[model samples]
Target: MTTITRRTVEYPADGLTMVGHLALPSGHDRRPAVLLGPEGTGISDLQRRRADALAELGYVAFAFDIHGGRWFSDPEEMLARCLPLLADPDRLREIGTAARDVVLAEDRTDPERIAAIGYGTGGAVALELGRAGVPLQAIGTINGLITGRPGEAAHIRCPVWAGVGSEDPIQPAAQRDAFAAEMQGAGVDWRLTIYGGAGHAFHHPLDELPDQVLLPGVGYHEKHAARAWRDVLGLLGECLPSSN
Candidate 1:
């Protein structure tokens, strides 16, 4: 069984104590570390579960909180807290760096074998970390928007894999195509996987409520989620290894 521990780390930004769940591999030392960025709603049970799953795969995973203790009952409230952070690109980069610091400080964590994975708004934060030249082994995003703007794809020193829904209204085919072009132009090892028939937030199984921003009729696709999970693990395995 994977061993998991919940802890709190203070971010210099706003001096806020963000609660995090750390998962460690059983009977392992100096394992790779992963900084997991939660969805816009903050760190939930699902995110914790993902961290545990990562630990089971032999990595020390830390899931950081963006909203502290605040969780929104409505989508608007979530957006209210997440949108401003997204709009200010600098803050987004700070959040990712703060989370990375927390994970790297652990004695058992391998600093050179670190990665960042995010969902939705958190995904954008991960992308910003890559854009800011954070020395991460890999970066992954789930159903996140990657605005194809100049200087966005450049400076990514690591491989990036973005999982998006082909039917996601927020991120259409054109946007994904543009992002791919930018990554290729930047000479970054990047890949985008489009899941057909899935809508936005395809990895969020609990997003069944009636939210205008996210379709209430749309729900998580289990098959696609499983596939994405495997793909993420493969990416991490390639980017973060004990030997490397």
Candidate 2:
């Protein structure tokens, strides 16, 4: 197994202390980097693990944080905090940019070979960064909010890959159609995948949250999760190749 290093990184954004998990592969050579965003509940161990996995795959991954250092198990609590942030695109840009600065400042990161990937609300931030004209090689989102403002997608400078559950109420057909239409209108290279037999947050493992509420249409599907991960890695390989 390839050795990797992990560290907690603290940053600032929107008057909150954002704490992210940064993972680096064991090498001196600069490596391609990814900025990872978490679900609306905030940065959890799940996203941290994804950072480690990306590091093992030879990329520097920083699991960017939102909600300061807190995570919500209650949907109401999460929505209360996330809804307002989601509504303001400039605020979202601040959050994504703050976390992104941390990753880019890393000595081991290849500044030109960077990407963004996010899940749920985090995914929305990734899109925000892209639409804000961030120079990323690719953007990969799963179960993310794909809604965009008018003419904003024209700034996207790289490919985008989005994966969502077929029955995801949070990202129903209307949202998907709107996302696609925007991408097409902007002449952006994008693809969307609808995993069959899956619902919202289907990639999430069983809830380990202490006060977890079992929400409808938000269950795990192991097979689809794996498939989506593979698709994400594929996007990275195709965009920011290892040999870069």
Candidate 3:
């Protein structure tokens, strides 16, 4: 039987209480914890499902909400809510730090084995956390963009795995190549997997229109989504130690 628990945490930052979902693996001691960041839509059912799936894999997972528990169906609203925080570097750091602390505070979580994974805007936060010298075992970003320039790449101290879709217009091939070069030049352990036919939010089937962000001739591919998911799980297992 798989054990999973869900609870809300109030992250007191900047005088606001940001609610988050914490999922723990039952019958485990000091398991590695993963900080799960939501996409631009905040903490949706999909994010919660991901956390539960991680818990089933024997990981304590925290799906942290940067959007203060609000959900929006409109793309414009999602962008409006997420863009301001992404634009402000300081707030972004504060929120990330707060979420990291929340996961670390759990007794069942292994302090030294914490990793972070995010999608889209949340992916930027995960990358920023690693770049800001946060003590993380690994960082994974899916269909996300890097906010700052490439100069800060030297500060990353852990392995990074980035999954991007070839059809993702938000992240152009040239930019991804530049980012990979920067990571390599900084001597950072990094790997980037580009899905040849996938578009943005490839893993998220719940999106009203997954192919809406597709280019004039590009669209999402299901095969790439499966491949990316497998790669992410393998990378996380490699970076984070098992409780057993």
Clash pairs detected, candidate 2: none
Question: Any idea what lDDT model 3 has?
Answer: 0.79
Evaluated with lDDT, which candidate comes out highest?
2
- What alpha-carbon RMSD in Å does predicted model 1 have with respect to the real structure? 2.8
Of the two candidates 1 and 3, the one with more favorable TM-score, higher being better, is 3
Off by over 4 Å in 3: 147-150, 207-220
What is candidate 3's lDDT per residue for 8-54, written digit by digit as tens? 89887534778888998888478998988877767777788888888
Sort by lDDT, top down from the best: 2, 3, 1
Q: TM-score for candidate 3, please give it.
A: 0.89
lDDT of 2 by residue, 1-244 (tens): 7899999999999899989999999889999999999988889888899899999989999999989999888888888999898898899899999988998899999999999999998999999999999999999989985677899999999999999998888888998898888899999999999999899888778855656775678888999999998998899999987752
Which segments of model 2 are wrong by more than 4 Å? none
lDDT of 1 at 136: 86
lDDT of 2 at 147: 72
